[model samples]
Target: MSAPPVHDPPAAGVVRLPHTGLQVPDARLRVVRCRPHYVNRWEYRALLVRGEQRIGHIRGPLPDVAEPGPAGVAGGGPVVSFHPRGRAFTEAELEDFAAACRLDGQGLSSARVLTLLVDEYRIEQMVRGCARRGGVMARCCGEGWVHYIPLRAYPRSAGQCAAALAHLERASGVGGPWRIWDGQQWSPLSVGSGPDTSPGCA
Candidate 1:
């Protein structure tokens, strides 16, 4: 008799894998939430998840918006404003920031903790992507230019890893996505039915 034909299993809605490689699972198998921040600068952020665990996030900085110089304008006065102010955190800087946040003894609302981990991991992933693509050129103020040379890349910092686990522990108690206030109301993210559902319950 002939051997039975081999058959692949049906696709799973969600899958978990070891976090040691550069593999990203299919988007359709994950829960994703997108939020907008800074309308004037056009910043959009997204959170990614598999099952109930957050996997990562995406953050894109504002793109350049300088108009072409006027016709017949010689030299263009050195393109003084091509590069905008405000620097994104370097990998080392982000690591340090996360560490500081951990040690500061300042209590973080559950949402804030989640947001922090999401943003930091996302930034680290971007740095790794840039590095894998050889290198990237960064332009500033139209006149200033620099190349971002990556010495190392990481998916998660020590502080971020700790914070994520901590948030998850607390998250188990909170029910559903809800608002948090740091002197002001913050938008909700993720929803669940759990023990603690009140403000700052986690």
Candidate 2:
């Protein structure tokens, strides 16, 4: 006889559900529910991930039927668009998902939600500061958008960001960005700062 299957624990700030479907055997699929950076009240996305790679995603208001799936989700919802590679979700799978994340309209805890809101506000403020000051490293949020991150907040190739410390150092005209201070004035950086290196002139 085979032993019962074991599942991995969910990551921090991420809620996950075990998938019991034949789509991908060995219980590899994980149904994750979390608040995205741009989510409305009670709105969240259900991401389907196989192992470490994300396979697909569906968005909608939780505790209610999600947006009609492209392949006609398990619910009576009709199909609007179709993708050749998309897989249809079975009724059982949908039911399990609903049961896992059952919640009322108010949504997650007020304290937790408030903390996330404050964090987002601070990030936006920093991005705006980058635009007003010089040293913006990149422009995001579609074309023509002024949203950016200053070189001081740029992440290293290893995905490390010492943004707060960098900000203080740069303000003192010591270190940070693609430039340095040589007692009298700031000068171009002497070496590449890994992935955060500034773009060269054309």
Candidate 3:
């Protein structure tokens, strides 16, 4: 028999992937409680806040919704609990979370951000609905410049990658564009004025 369609009901134990839709607006957070599991890692209960109002709770090992261990606790990983809107955490936001919890430097960098992993092969599976095939499709600044480029065309280093994206934006005359299917909705890419000598995020 032919395999089931992509949208067909998933078999037992199958997982649906998530996307990074947006950043939490005016976000403020505080860790109310924490339970340590592994070194530099903890399961936490936090409050998501906006201005002076408490908005929601962020309870996590991030994997609890996907694979909970005994008693509904999740196995070890970075501490993360996204908002209901499928938004991802930013580095600055994660730092804020870590600060409120008084986490050491090691723990500070362990906060997880939700994002889609894109590779040459995975790009094929991800961009299924696009008329194009093989390479990934991208659109920036709402300009009519929609096209597909292979993953190899993109540089791996942050400095190089940012430069390439900046060049692409200038060439296409699009300001601050969000590419399709990448799960990254951030604005147009640009590097700082000086040489980016520092090593990218560790």
Could you give me the TM-score of model 2 versus the true structure? 0.21
Best by lDDT: 3
For 1-202, candidate 2 gives per-residue lDDT tens digits of 0111233332233332111011121234444433442334544444545466555554433334335432223255432111112445543443343222211111222112222222333344444556466433332222212222346443433323454334545554434343332222223333333231222111
Model 2 off-target regions past 4 Å? 1-24, 36-42, 64-202
Ranking by lDDT: 3, 2, 1
Question: lDDT (CA) for every model shown?
Answer: 0.31, 0.33, 0.34
* Model 2 poorest 10 in a row by lDDT: 16-25
Candidate 2 displacement at residue 73 in angstroms:
7.5
For model 1, residues 1-202, the per-residue Cα lDDT tens digits are 0111223332333221111111122322221555556756654456645456554554433224323443111144321111111343233432332222320123322223333334334434544466576532111111222112222222135564344334533644433232211112122222332232222211
Error of 2 at 96 (Å): 16
lDDT of 1 at 95: 30
